[model samples]
Target: MTSTKDEISLAGRREWLGLAILALPALLASLELTVTHLALPSIAADLRPSGSELLWIVDIYAFLLAGSLVTMGALGDRIGRRRLLLGGAALYGVASVLAAYSVSPAMLIGTRALMGLAGSTLMPSVVALVASMFKDTRQRGVAIGIVVASVSGGTAIGPLVGGWLLDNFWWGSVFLAGVPVMAALLVAGPRLLPEYRAPGSKRLDPVSALLSMAAILPVVYGLKQIAADGFAWRWTGAIAVGLVLGAVFLRRQRRLADPMVDLALFASRVFSASAIALALAIFVLWGVNYAIAQFLQLAHGLDPLTAGLWTAPSAAGTIAGSLLAPRLAHRFPPGGVIAAGLVLAVAGFAVLTQVGPLGLLVTGSIVISAGLAPTMALATNLMIGAAPAERAGGAAAISATAPQLGGALGIALLGSLITAVYRDQFGHDAELTREALGSAAGADAFTTGFQVSAGVSAVLLLVTAAGAARFLPR
Candidate 1:
């Protein structure tokens, strides 16, 4: 491991305080991810976007964020982590204002893309800083847990905050929420976060960066289009082109003396398994979360605030799981704890399949979120730990990318399934308006959609649990 005098000392009080400051940006990044879900209807009403445009509004952020993560992480190593982070935060604040004031669908989408680009910088920087700050393994575990908790917690709380704002103000308020938080981070971050860069890191490859975006953007866009409109030549062509470009990207990385992505990292069984598991876990969590949020507001006919309040349990459960994970790992093997967490998610998904009342839905969400949180946290810890200390930024970027990809796939796959089921079950009914389908026959359609999605999610979680048991280090 490459070392410097800056990283030689064991962390003390200042380091911990710095962790708290770093969390603001991390929380800001994650909060933006989920906070827009409840506000979609409001935006649609005001902006009058088409169906495809509506989907793009949400998916674009994840698409760009996933595409840029590795490159930004590598950029952090070459430049400086804190420097990129602070710059990104400044840009994020401006993007938020543009998003909030957007008058057209195209403008909103463009601003969200900017937000995603800015977010890409923040995600890896803070995590890498944490890895640098707390050198002790046990302390790093807790510190990482806190950071993970901040992310999951932001997702859980996003709906409530967004809902409250929507109830009191306009949908634009959701995007505006980030302005002050980013400002706070800007103020506090420079004082707290220590800058770290990889020694002897090579100059970033512009071709690799372009190729990464080219590969990811088309694949994600194609997958989303496939879900919205059944297999078409354009969608298939996009996927094929993406795959070819991805192959070329991989080949170029192998040829580089200092690649943007080190091919050798995947060779470690621990890193690969943990990364895959993290992705799968997030895939299920985000998919289910998307379905539930719609179910609460559209089907159950709850106002935004009530829906937010009901959903709060899931975030609470995630926080509980994060705090409990390290202690559980001390008693049980890490793999076992992760497997147990998946099993809990399985139970939660099963509960949703029953199509019970709000109480049952809430209970299932709590259980599922609680189960998934520790799995994500512990798996991330493993991925970060498996890497060389100097490469922590890239490793953390990969870990962050898994969830972004999963969440995008989730919104595309599960959201499409819901639309398909809703149209099949109630689309022909003249009584239901397109937007008012929720008020008309929403319950039957949304519940059917939720049941279908939940059943699939449960099976995936079970299989993933077995994989966790078999592949992860015991």
Candidate 2:
């Protein structure tokens, strides 16, 4: 009884259900990114990982995920998005189980890397599928908003989820949470989701794949090193090599008949501007999130669960802002709306500089998160929209890659600035300088770090706001 038109129509019960299924993988991927931060202490106590090993356990997932996104995205276009999604889901579920049961730190780190590889496939496929599924402009906007919101929401709630699990269960319980979610997605995704692949797509190039990994992994590793051990020559060297490899990757893309990434996509002003704005927006988001978590725990002496609960309002604000963005964009110029959101975030950061009270910090976090969410959502929509229909997977991959790199760079650079300022205040007092300058000086040092970091975050947001207004197309 179903006509061809009825089968392909965008608006339907099946499409909506499929969207919900797609959101699960995106949410789980983002949750895994930050969930480990809360469990590190418990992991350390149980596994007895050295400082360097602990850092590896945390960094490997993101490093591999960011590195593999483009290659996997392009591969999905050559193969099938649905196939890639299901395959990744299976791998992710298996990896989660292994990670949950791992007795050694090395075993855990290896499984986390496998999860990242699986995650790389899931992220791009979900976004590209959303882009392909929603043919209407308005409907697509809302779909993208929902997908983007899940990612941001997951990031916001990751610690809270981890904290609650740690409170009631063992550290391994954090890894097990994803097992059920992945299972549900794997079971339902095939039945509900449509298959998509770029017509006439060429085979993936091995050299470009390796080059892409080489370009991204070192940059992320260098940033992690800067965050953990401060700036070092080796880290700088690693970054330099990454930049050179990145240049090579770009040059290779330009010459290839069937490139892994279509270099010409960046020619669209909307794509380039939106991508940059999204990256900068994420920089502010991740950096401020890290700084605020520290403030809640150290400055206010709140327990992990309590601190996470306090930040929950900020996550709510983000979801509200994302849902509200499409209506605002309809009424105002998109560039202006995005700029206005950044300005609001700047104001939020300004409140943090005052270091008034817990209420003020919470108020600032809500405003900043809410304001930033709209820019991120709209910018992501613009990036995906600007690309050709066939290149949706590659475009989504680039868009996703920007935020991963931005978050790493933001946390490293901004967090280091806060650490340096906190240490400077201690004036070479070794006792006071231990454990992030808060163990000895108590709330005073935490307050200083909070104020300094807020100042930096505010200034960056102001600059980014101006850029968004100037560069993002109305």
Candidate 3:
């Protein structure tokens, strides 16, 4: 509807290349997260990281990624999306090599955070690229679908691939694996990806960018710390700072010449609700998935490879949901379908608490993922679908931002809560810590920590479900 928005159909070589380039970042981002999770135990042993430190290594990237995305999205609009993508690819490759060589947990986590900066440039560009490449509405839908599918599918596949790598190599090998993939993307990206910039947006806002990071980092860091030490003043201070900064950031954005988040979009109930739903869905799914991975390895005594195999049910369900969402969207509005998916996810988590018998836990995961996958896809579609064409980049950025935040929050808050509950049950026992984390901490401390992580995860899931029903449209 906007004049600056071009109209052309995406087809043939140009369209395919554009979409592939776009999907590459999503794949990389998802891959980075998935591989880290599978490698956590290995990293724990090699680095001898404390239970809290291990959570930080696993949780920090998402927070950085989420925190930086809004600013990066706006930058893409001011600069050129394709130029940003190429630079991001190069940065990702360098970070990958650095990550592979990390001698300590601190180094690896720091490298991962840097990787998040590169990744921040990758996602908004991808969505903006699709909009730039495809002029026709129908073609745009298809392009978005494939791009979305590739990223979502990569997440499902990450554990399987990570499992394979862990079987044969050190945990660092998983980080090393990014090199080839990123190298290929870097080389192909420049030639295949076309440049795009917002026609009218020539200036970028510095204040908003700083505020955005301030608003996000504390909350994310706070949540991560909570996993190791529950209900502490330190955690409370961090969260409060983040929340207050976030409020200030939002206020500044409204008056900015070139704001990262377009406050006006909330007027469209569809857009706002969809964004919230997307975040909530990720919060629930990934949070639980994190616990499930640990349980598979620790309780079931499965190797990373075996854990991946068991998780195939959840992955398959995600794929099934993606495949079915387009059709379901026609019968049920995108919002309604997303809301339904939340209900199903809630049921899945509830079932997890009860499934000690008849593989109840494992069986419940499939049902939960089945519901979540479609919801993820639909929420993504709605976030952009209702936006003004010229603001697609902003809309997509909002969509991505929520999930990044959700992922960090989910792991931090839920992981911590689970650890608290797990520890409470142990009641200051030496063997409990020794048996629980194995080598994560002092005897009594670590067991208490791990259970808190699991319990927090369950409680947050309930909150995520509740949020979906109340804030999202049915």
Whole-model lDDT for model 3 versus the true structure?
A: 0.72
Please list the residue runs of candidate 1 whose C-alpha ends up more than 4 Å from where it truly belongs after superposition.
Answer: 1-9, 426-441
Per-residue lDDT for 1-474 in model 2, tens only?
977765565577788889999989878865775566656656766888775676577667766877888889888888999999999989998999899889999999999999878888887888778877886667778987898778767866777897798789888888888888889988898899999998788899999999999998787667656655566999989999999999999999999999988889999988888888888888877777766666666567665677667776787778888888988888888889899999999999998899758888789988998889888778878888788876776787788778766765676566656666665676644344445423224568668877888888889889988988988867
Which scores higher on TM-score, 1 or 2?
A: 1
TM-score of every prediction relative to native: 0.94, 0.90, 0.88
Candidate 1 lDDT by residue in tens digits, 1-474: 646654565688889999998878767765776668777777877898876777789888878887888789889889998998899989989999999999999999999999888888887788778878887777787887898788777876788898899999998999998899889888988898899897789899999999989998888778766655556999999999999999999999999988888878888888988888888998888788777777887888777778778877788888889888988887888988999999999999999999658889999999998999888778888888899877677787787777767776777787777766665676444233245423424677768877988998899989999999988879
For 225-314, candidate 3 gives per-residue lDDT tens digits of 564445689888998999999999989888876677899887887788777767877786677777677666666566888777777657
Which run of 10 residues does model 2 get worst, by summed lDDT? 432-441
Question: Candidate 3 — which residues are off by over 4 angstroms?
Answer: 1-13, 135-138, 428-435, 438-474
Which residue pairs clash in candidate 2?
A: none
**How does residue 126 of candidate 3 score in lDDT?**
83
TM-score: model 2 vs. ground truth = 0.90
User: Which is better, 2 or 3, measured by lDDT?
Assistant: 2
Q: Which is the leading candidate under lDDT?
A: 1
